[model samples]
Target: MASHLFVSSTRSFSCLSLILKPSPPLLGVKTLFSRSTRFPRTYKPLVRHGSNAHPKLLSALSSAPPVVAWKSSELSSARDDVVILGIETSCDDTAAAVVRGNGEILSQMVSSQADLLSRYGGVAPKMAEEAHSLVIDEVVQRALDNANLSGNDLSAVAVTIGPGLSLCLRVGVQKARKLAGRFNLPIVNVHHMEAHALVARLIERDLQFPFLALLISGGHNLLILAHELGHYLQLGTTIDDAIGEAYDKTARWLGLDMGKGGGPALEELALEGDANSINFSIPMRQHKDCNFSYAGLKTQVRVVMESKNISIENNPISSANSEDRRLRADIAASFQRVAVLHLEERCQRAIDWAIKIEPSIKHMVVSGGVASNKHVRARLRHVVETNDLQLICPPPSLCTDNGVMIAWTGIEHFLSGRFDPPPPADEPDDAMFELRPRWPLGEEYPKGKSEARSVKRARVHPSLTSMIQGSFQQQL
Candidate 1:
């Protein structure tokens, strides 16, 4: 069975019946004037229904003695030059970036927890949260400074809200909310996996809707058919541990350097060893579906380690004898070969499935942390090319978690008028946030839906349920 975690869902658009005098319109601008009790008689009106109002307008309303009417040209300009600041703290990295609507990445900053991962062998959520807290402010500030802009200059503040560690995600979300509130900017809540998929669009301007995407990362392996922005049909997902998790475990067991995370270290080590040295079996050979499973392959490596008496406790890579090191490298080579073969096989099948449903799909986007692997990219590129489809892989920098993707995805949603209103600047620190640590990107295709749907649906947070349901209200 597959699972999902959501970040932001549709905000309620319920009509409020207010009995008040009508205000004069300017340039066909329709304003919904409302008094903020917390900020006193200041008419802080959000142009929810205005022909000239730009959805991405930044600090359009002032909280002073009187409300100012924005000119139509100003709103049009806002639409043309939407600037967004995106913050991401989904796991072990604290990342931020500033991007313009035209796909210009002004600045990007990432504070990686490499040392922590090296010491702890993996990310400890609470510890990761602390690390994010320590560097998040600096990272965001540096991104803004490098971009040569201030918070008020941004049209909206975007942040990854879910499909990550709750503790770690809070650091970024809280920062975004605070910044948005302080600057009176709209908030664009983003999904982590969605950002990974959509960031390819930022780089490839010609990419269009109804495409195929393979999102592979530390915690997820998903095959989705993107019908359009915010509309997707899930083709497949991991049935067990993700490929990145398997790589990390394999790297640790092999006593390989984990300073840069396991996937890259393993990929580097595989370069020296022969790929055909080990006879490890590929996973799920009998399963014709697109879903993935790495647990069995991981177990196979464990058995090999036990038989070879390669104990990590006694032999770190630095102290290992030449022969033992060679053996480890061979294992790395073999493991990566089969692991990627699994991805290749699933992608081929997913393409067949996706093409049947959406014949217009001409591209396959491969992205995420694992997608940064050169071997993975080359192998998948071959698969895509053979199917007569273009392969759209973001450069390695964009493949990994970063703020640019979030900002770009935010811009997509904002243009569609899908965003939340500005949060109150004085909101209490203890206020609850709308976080989705396990939100699904989209519904499973009926033909692919598993019996686990009920179980997965039951685990969703009530607030997330309302938002997700509201988001797909059109589908309903």
Candidate 2:
């Protein structure tokens, strides 16, 4: 690691004061402080072991590395010309994008690990990390190139720091720090789930805070109330696996194509069969809380598949005979129905609870990889509309894991002066960075649990019950 100089100062200043160490031949750069440590009001002496009382100062020094000095003016919160490059390697996707402060998407790029996912059945952390290391550079460069700009043109670098795989998060963080250092740009650390929720504001310019958001993906299912920038109250979360993971596992059990991801393939297959065919129970029916549980539903599908003698081996859709294919399709359709129904149920309760807390809430943003599903969007739309709230779902491309959301979320934080100074250009490869593999979006709502218990569970639609009984009897 590169040696770092520690500066101790108790005085406050309106701007940054930095001392530069001259390169080899020129020892001419004099220290601002005299040999006796006499210095100006804003200047402080260098210390080998400083007082541990200055945590903020220490954090700034340790996390951001060293070298370049940033003035307070440079950290202005209202710079309208701010352009950020957002980098996301939270999971299997390596994505990068350029987004203007005004929500203009200059360029975006994603290098997916669909092949790896298909081969391994899911994301293998070690393999996923290696894959990210290989393509992250190329993807970021492409994003910059397509934006008709270079790293130096960017005002700041925004990257997802947590709520994802630590190894994958590190790949993006290191690349971001390296770029920010090279370009002398500020850095903004982002929470992965917050990025998913805040990106809606980018698409819907009128999307104000105090709105409800249901973020669904392979690893997370969250219902949060966005109180304001950097302030949120989580209303619901997954007690078990996320909806996207359930979708992938269901697709695999049905022998659907694993290419292009299991969610899309399963959605397409569901389109061909009766959605009410299997009657798998919606998860968390007995519980009136917004918390989700897809694990049981996944098990239900496995049981029904086994009862029908469907092999769990790698049986592709193409190899299945006509009857087998239809049976699989029925299972797919039914599984998707219950999975989404669970989401719908949770969202309805969340909205009810949210509105009581923030009656001004008028829009509900549904985002994440699973939000790309037309069925999921449609179902959630009804729930939002019934509560007199407009539903805002980003375009299909933005719904999935991508760099644009990171870039956009970065813009939100940049405007609030929440960012770090650029690191040293020669920041070592082993330099430690802040990485959060399990960061929460925000704090849990204090009344969320109490309010949930008071909310009555709506009756399951009669048609759904009848369909469930019919499907179960037929299978037996």
Candidate 3:
């Protein structure tokens, strides 16, 4: 039987509940601190000493080496069931969670920067970093409190260390390093995109390796083939701006609410308008490659808005007359339709290319913040179904950045023995870890072995192709 440790905190007493079975015991444990409060408590080891041991046991114990403080190396060798505290500040949100080895999320907490979006128009890296610095400790403590566990109980610490704002990423990496050193836990540095992709497997057990993944977010637009744990085959990516970024820009131009993020606000406004009211050109219609380009579409929207004399500043969408509001909605709807169509074209090509490499690939996993968009999800679902593939998307909440995904990814990596040693005690926080603001998801497609060759031989379902082409033609 396995032992369970539950650590709960209260004003009067901090309780540590332990149910131990016959097994190798933890040794030489010392103090545990509640960082939220100033109080520190000490707990002695549960092992019996000297006279309490039987004669043979006493003889064996007397000859054994003295155990000092617990370290990650010792912990890994003693236990397979690990608990991870995942911290994520790779973007505007500060989030943390505690997850167990068996894909169970014990507790999760997120501190969003929605309040700052309106003031700054969008995420200002420095302001976002400042916000993360302020709330990260509280968010992490809340997660631990909700889980009824302490740092000492955690087997490892995981953090999103790359492909984000340099300032924001540093906040999370610094916090993770501090916890790893204090708790003597192994550290796992997770790739932000990989975490987004692998998190699907946690929610759907049937989701396996070598499936297609479409990761669309504020910063990324990627279509990849997940070959296995920590390995990916890149199929397509955005050549200019990501789809989510375009959504934000358009929303800002149209004066959509920024409180819930521009993408969601625009998505909501789009529902009220006719999608065909104003036809936006589908981007990259003539490009044969799977690579995406959204800059052209963004320029087109700007030009059209200017030509119509639409002023988001003088007459905000919230306070506009009915006629202006209708026009705003129409623009939102038209832009969303064309944006999703671009995704459909790329996805159709990607699915065909992927099947040639791995015929067993039958699921399309779309994730990231933009994947939470209802319009994006509904359209992508149609695209996947048309290709005879099941669509797997994490719940809208999980689609955005969260600690649960990072923790879950850590669990996968931990089980596979992929980890790094904690930072040296003498190292400075700034120098401890490297942050990749522009890290590619994996290696780019090789020159000679590009998916383009396979794409040439692969055939897209005629109905899907015609449906997409017809939509573009109607817009034209």
The list of candidate 3 runs beyond 4 A from truth reads 1-80, 425-427, 446-476
**Better by lDDT, candidate 2 or 1:** 1
Return the clash pairs for model 3, or none: none
* C-alpha RMSD between model 1 and the true structure: 9.1
Question: Could you tell me every candidate's TM-score relative to the true structure?
Answer: 0.83, 0.79, 0.78
User: Candidate 3: TM-score?
Assistant: 0.78
lDDT of 2: 0.74
Off by over 4 Å in 1: 1-79, 450-458, 461-476
Question: Which is the winner by lDDT between candidate 1 and candidate 3?
Answer: 1
Q: After superposition, how far is residue 151 of candidate 2 from its true place, in Å?
A: 2.1
C-alpha lDDT of all candidate models, in order: 0.77, 0.74, 0.73
Candidate 1: tens digits of C-alpha lDDT, residues 69-106: 54656644554556688999998878898887767778
Highest TM-score scorer:
1
User: Candidate 3 at residue 42, lDDT?
Assistant: 17
Tens digits of per-residue lDDT, candidate 3, 1-476, equal 11112232222112211111122222232211111111111112222222222243223223322232234554333223456889999988888888766567788888888878766788889999999888888888888888877876676789997778889999999988887777656677788888899889889988887799999998888888876665677778777788989999899999887877999999999998889988789987766656777888998888878888897564568788898888888889999999999999989988988888899987999999999998888999999999899999999878999998999888776544345655554567557457767666654454213332232222212221132234334433
Clash totals, every prediction = 7, 1, 0
Best-performing candidate as measured by lDDT: 1
